[model samples]
Target: MKRKSNIKVIRIPIPTPTLLPHTTTNSYLIGNEEESILVDAGYDTEDTRKLLEWEINKHGLARPKRIVLTHAHQDHAPGVRMLIHWMPTILCHEKEEEQVLSAISPWEEITLIEDEDSIKVDGEEIIVMHTPGHTLGHVSLYIPSEQILIVGDNIVAEGTTWIGAPDGDMKDYLQTLQRLRNLKIEKIGPGHGKWVHQPHEHIDFVIQRRLHREQQLLTLLEKHQQITSKELTEIIYQDRIHPSVFPVAQKTIEAHLDKLLKEDLIQYDESKSSYVSPHF
Candidate 1:
């Protein structure tokens, strides 16, 4: 890809954060001189594609070379079929291949990628960073030239990202946050909510919040001796989030407990079916 001129990053906001108060997911149209790439086509309907297409046309952008996904979550990869109709290649981390395939089946034209891989749009290069933990294959794209990072679900601007177990891991999520914080990012385009103008500040806020929450959980456990994850969720997140979101919040709290367990600060008692602090 040759840089005919300075590259442009266009935010194509699609309202899709149904569970949260967020109004939209920031789908980006990135391009430079000759080619463009669409990041996270998650709208899940033809209307999404139409909106994207209209944006492309409205800006006079070149047809995208490919549609790249940050992860396999429904809100990030749903418009795959519609984007494929335009003959653009679908790209995602190889680790998320199965999850993406499951969403849009019988479509095998995806270009699987790995961490540290570089994607070229026109003449510019977008480096891929495997920032998992939100999901097994979550990735973020970094443009060295512009110092802009397209952080998928690894971090969000509006509300904190949910790190549920089985798929999401608090340990990995925290590690990923630390790794990204070291990056030279000027602007952050997240999968949800608006763009983050102060990249490092926003990342610091997210990391501190999670750590603070974990500390709160630890204090609660120290006093209770042993408690079920649900019990901890109630104590720590009660009234902070809606009741309907408690189930997911419990899963996140469990991730924190699991991380603590891994650190030998806590232990899960099989007989009690609860987690106990190290003091116990």
Candidate 2:
């Protein structure tokens, strides 16, 4: 566990069976000694539960009375099952209710939250911002006093966060980044990996990198005339990613295609099962 800022912000990196390069999901303890909130629960495992409890005791902070979820991802929300003994009130965005419910038992208590809603921990306010893109109900917590943002999977310490279809939207993700960039954030505690100290610069890099990928898709479509998302994924990320991640890369490409198609920047050839540049 690591502490940040003048406030009692403890980052508890709980081990989980997450994706490669990220073996643990960050569960944060934010509040004063009297009352606190736990953000994200990691995966559902006895070990994860014990580690979290141990960390809280070790830090000498009160057991979190609330568990605020950023989203309903497997690695982030499943651990609530183990914490059912604690009976902490589970809170998530309204849009995420279905997913969160599906992950936990029916008897668990849940509260729906929305954008601009404030959660207080010992008089300190943590504002919830609906930052979708990673997921429809993804939220990032803002601590005005410390100028810190706790982003789930929206912004990672390493490579960019994956924005694929069904749950992910490239367009919404890009807009979320822009919105976060406008905030006066001093540091960001992401769901995985180390903390992000340079918030704006990192947000800008994520934005530009996504735009650059979109441009790459457009350029590839213009040259190839007609290309499937699978083909585009191969050409764009060939050798840079492992075969296991190809499906994810393809989905991201499809999301980009969806955005471009909506903007009339590209056209889809339904009969050919491929996308083409408008000029083509």
Candidate 3:
């Protein structure tokens, strides 16, 4: 059944799934005066879709007007086709079109959100802010009228976000944090965390924490002189590296090294797996 909030929102927690525990998915049921919309869909699982259907039916929500994915990660988009069967406009950032379109769903449909583009849903404008870093196409949806921001994997209140191995960029992620700071948001819907009631404070914490970590990586690079990106990450992350996140951590470190190299801050010898920072 629909859990009613004064503003017409029902939060449905979808399990993120794994051998270990982490924040549960916090997909949202946002209803306007009459119709409704879903923020992120949990993992691509039969159970997830089934639960979603139950929530929708309970609310007596008309077919959702749209399924807005915060990013294209499979964990968030699997239910797109299933949900759309009810008839909702699917929207994702233009930058993410490559990743989203590449998803290869049986249903071939999606609309790219242009930069500075805002889509009107029942007179409420949900502006798309292009924030790359976690993924090249990652974007957050902001509703200025409500001071609410729907951020997907940008920053999770319960845990640190990953630059994540395999294409997650540290520099871009940092820049995105700065951009979010300008929003002065009051409420947050993180992809995998508890609802954030203290938005600006949390943004500051994430930004400062990332900057401190960046400095730590740079310092370690200089001290070690020559080390592969993997070696560098091991030294920097040390015991904090969990086996689950090690691969992701390695990729993120490499992205940082690449950016540092571009700025003449570090160098890699192709003959070896090591890289050296100018400070060292």
Candidate 4:
């Protein structure tokens, strides 16, 4: 689909065996007649490969010269294996090299990118923004001409993006959200769901929701004295989340705990195998 600017963006929802509620990952074909860039290939499957090829052929988009991955998640980057025939130059943040390589083949050459790197597609500049949080190397592409931002997994159309431990960080995620809110964005093409029109408002909602959850965790920590992340998740989410999502919720709770611990607001009790307020 053509946006307000000269660039064309076609959102192809590729089916993937991802987490609950997210049945497909949105891979975008963005560019003009001169060149095209495919953002985020879905999981490695014949179905995914066929769908992507169909979309490209239907749109008559030129063979994408490059494949820019937002992160190295299974649902996002593994499909690069299917596109090896295109010999497209793979691009991703330096921090994501290890994971990206693991997802694809180790022998595949990857070009590392940093913040502010500009990719010219048919004369239009697409600025890369390293919006780490959901993952250490997550990036969002910005089109200054169209005031559009294509966020990989930073912001979704429905609910909230998971900020779990290890790969995900609550502190970094909050900072990323604040940074995105300051951008001159009119539309957002997220990794999942439909396009977001109220960019700032959507960003603000995510920010506020995270902050509220953080505050709730603090309050619970104070009330419970020493509580495990799993226990905290049970209290915070209760029966709202499915049994299958319990582990994900617990990981997110652990991320919040890690943030609070770093801030010296909470302390982990080794003996109790739980977290507690610093004063406790």
Candidate 5:
């Protein structure tokens, strides 16, 4: 792919069930020529492809090379089969190989890209970094020349990202943010939410927010020594929080509990959703 010298980003909005409008996932069409690579595919529905096709035709794209995912979120990983049905490969974070292999993904074929991985598209090289926390295999894509970081769910531009249990980690997520701070990023192309104008500053803010949430989790567990995940989630999510986002938050708290349990900070008895803190 050759640089057209008139390249720009074309965004396709996918709004699912959420507090945010038109922002479940954003499929970014980035190119320096008529051929472009898609960042993330929308939900697993015909509408996603139709919307993308409309955008592709509208932009006069001559070719679709590859489709990329920030992580294997249901909303973000869909339509890869549709994409690979036409394109060469659907690139994913190498950490996501299991997600892809598990057929948990709606796609058939996917190539993994890990941290320190790079790909050439439209005369530009995109670097991949394993920014896990949202998911063990979640990745952040970076364009060195552009100073842009196409982060998946590690850090949403606006609200905080979920560090749900089973995979998400508060410690890793904070470290990922710190890792990004070391990079000279100018624009943050997030998987969801608005574009981040102040790159590193926004990342710092996100890190602070995650740490605060971790503290809140610690306090919540200390206050309620014995509570079911459902009950804890409800208590954690106040009236102001959207119900749609609670499930994810619940998973995040569960993830923290699992971690704390491993560190002997907390003990859990699955028969009861209660968690006991050693420090308490």
Candidate 6:
């Protein structure tokens, strides 16, 4: 199931409004003369479909054999239904398939992928990496031959990816970052923003930023005897984020708190209804 060695990936950028700072969601077309597949069709609008068709026609890409979703986020998976008429097999990780199909009508031809599963388009092998954090079932695809990692919200090219609480775990995010850093990636094709030319730097920067944010959060907590997640969010992130995005920022803050609490560096004071630094 590998694509031909000569077929290069074509990135079809589509405009989609999500909570993210970026304006366009990148849908990648991977294929060759024999077969092709699409990754992350985020925009389902008529205009988006037109653009996709235009790109396919412009580049002379064969109709895709399947559509692979990296995650089930609204910004990434919503467009699947629009392309369902194309009759491509919709594929996602087993852990993420349910979430991916939650909003769309069920179809009998869905394939659940797993880590190390290689999806061959033409003849190229696209390897799956189950890198959860931004979402529990989030995944990143690695094309070993091309050394390109298609990082779906796991690593945004510009603004940091928000790790939501409950479903999003900071600990898992950090682990995933580490996992990516260990890879031999040359470039990162993020779901949003520009392509990352140097993945090592991008991955390192992302991980360091998260660690630094945690440190800042810890310092903020230490400054106060006790602070609720809301209070903490107000003091640490409210000013930094727009009012409309404050809610999402709070969820990320809560995720950070969860990590600290798990590490015994912080504790939840049920009586005070606040988070307390163990040092305090």
For model 1, give the 10-residue run with minimal summed lDDT: 1-10
- What's model 6's TM-score? 0.94
TM-score of each: 0.94, 0.95, 0.88, 0.96, 0.85, 0.94
Q: What are the Cα lDDT values of the candidates?
A: 0.84, 0.87, 0.73, 0.88, 0.72, 0.83
Please list the residue runs of candidate 1 whose C-alpha ends up more than 4 Å from where it truly belongs after superposition: 1-5
Question: Can you give the lDDT of residue 47 in candidate 1?
Answer: 78
Best by lDDT: 4
Clashes of 2: 0
Q: Which scores higher on lDDT, 1 or 4?
A: 4
lDDT, model 1? 0.84
Candidate with top TM-score is 4
Q: Sorted on lDDT, highest at the top, how do the candidates line up?
A: 4, 2, 1, 6, 3, 5
Residue 132 Cα positional deviation in candidate 2, in Å, after optimal superposition: 0.7
Local error of candidate 3 at residue 165 (angstroms): 5.5
Higher lDDT: candidate 1 or 5? Answer: 1
**Clash totals for all models, in order?**
4, 0, 2, 0, 5, 10
Residue 199 Cα positional deviation in candidate 5, in Å, after optimal superposition: 2.2
Give me the runs in candidate 2 sitting further than 4 Å from their true place.
Answer: 1-6
By lDDT, the better pick of 4 and 6 is 4
Instruction: Give the per-residue lDDT of model 6 (tens digit) for 1-280.
Output: 3333667788877888876467788899887656788898876677777887788887888878698889877767778777767887888888887787784455446898888899887777889899989888888899988878998988888878889865798998999999999888779998888889989998999989889889988999889958898888898765777787788888988899898888898999999888987877
Candidate 3, residue 227: Cα displacement in angstroms equals: 1.2
User: lDDT tens string, model 1, 36-83?
Assistant: 999988767877888898998888788886888888777778777777
lDDT of 2 by residue, 1-280 (tens): 2234445788888888766567888999887668889999999899889998888888878888799999988899999999887878999999898999988765369999999999988878889999999899999999988888999999888887788878898889999999999998889999888899998999899899889999999889889989899999989997788676778778878888898998999999999899987887
Clashing pairs in 4: none
Alpha-carbon deviation at 14 in model 2, angstroms = 2.0
